[model samples]
Target: MQLCEKYVMQLLGMSFLQYSKTPMNDRWRDKDVTVFTMHDLVHDLARAILADPVNNKGSVVGNGCLYAFLTDCSKPLQLSATSSANIKALHFLDSGKLELRGDAFSLGTCLRVLDLSECLIRKLPESVGQLKLLRFIRAPRIRDQMIPNCITELSELNYLNLRGSHNLSALPESIGGMKGLMHLDLSGCHGIRELPK
Candidate 1:
């Protein structure tokens, strides 16, 4: 255990030694770790690290980390101007309780993938059309909401996932404008009755 701590400290320049508890029982003995909690922690940590301006300046696509997860809906997902400029992918997982701010989409001009699966977001800002580089989107299936026609403006979009979006009754006729699209997943989107010609 000491060896593991030492290795981690050497690698991460920090130590979890102080966080170690119940050394006699291997410290994890009484821990109540769950998959959800662990995922939340990982998401929080990724967001914190990516929020730093230092991580935003480089030309690294997606800041060399293509994924950012915001698991907690109680707090708004706020991205610094620079951080958003460099981010490539973002996920708002199962946040059915929170609404995403409109300005959030305007920041990630270079974003390629956006996952809003099961989120409570009611509308996407017109700025969503400004993300010309975006390639994938996972729109939520909230009944009262509809996907804006501006989504068709993503000419570079390759994948669209509307799985389980039960409330999505229609897609814009302009969807055919996405010439680059290759994969469309409408599984579980029972409300959709027809595809645009």
Candidate 2:
């Protein structure tokens, strides 16, 4: 029994080590690879984890492993695929000229936190309302941008930071409908003259 337990632990450790080395291997050997995206990395990680028999033993363990990998990774990337239903947070900092596809919002129905700080993206899709689970949004420097009125429909939103958005003139009148809002930062938004009633 002791030998069996030791073997099982070794197997688990090897599985984790194999996954942890994947991105590094790609970075070192695939210098010429240009088609790889964050979405591809995530998809590859999922496939690698699921292919392990230890993770596939139960849904609870599989999900736990996936979340652990995502949270513990030194650099987390933004969502870019329709298959990213389990992603909870997306951070797109300084990623140049991000042009979000129309169906992107619909794909991120499970997102809890979204940080697009300093990204070149000018506007958010009206389908932002579909992210009912979103709790935090930090989008700074999106000058002259007008957020969709549908944003007020995010009943779970708690923190919204729009600092340095100088040309953002106004908030939607329906802003009051976001009952869960606790913190709203509009610092550096010089165009706003009044708040909506």
Candidate 3:
């Protein structure tokens, strides 16, 4: 392990001894680091890593990683990846309505910022509460979607946006549970007639 660590440090400018020690465990915990590839990542490993709430660095992957996933069209959200770990911030394409359906509660944990604008989504997972560090959530086009009552668990959240969710007629009675909320946007929620106090 020591030799491998020295070699890895020489090749990547960092020590990998911590990773090498955990032979059975695929996850290597650290903070403030940036991941830039998915060549060695496996799907199960990614799931295990994301399921942990103790770490806080983001995984960065290349194009090949993008092709490795299969979509699940049944659930409200599905996330498949060889590398989507320790992400603090995420930017989605095709209108940010992530095609997360095959796997329920795939958003994982420890996220600080989430943006899913104009994605035409209809709902979010109750598992979103897994993101204990989440402070911002922005998904404007998901209409009539039932917010998980668990969302009230995100005591760290400061911002929430439901703008343009024209069909979101109701919100969790727990809306009043977000004690850290500083700004909320429901600008285009035409169907909403009441907010939880």
Tens-digit lDDT string for candidate 3 (109-194): 54565655524466775557777877767766775556678777889887787778887888889888778887788898888898
Candidate 1's TM-score reads 0.59
TM-score of each: 0.59, 0.58, 0.55
The CA lDDT of each predicted structure is 0.62, 0.60, 0.55
**Candidate topping lDDT:** 1
Of candidates 2 and 1, the better by TM-score? 1
Off by over 4 Å in 2: 1-83, 99-105
Stretches > 4 Å off in candidate 3: 1-83, 95-98, 102-107
RMSD in order of candidates: 11.4, 15.0, 14.8
Q: Please, what are the lDDT tens digits per residue for candidate 2 over residues 121-155?
A: 46665766888887767677665458888889898
lDDT-sorted candidate list, best first: 1, 2, 3
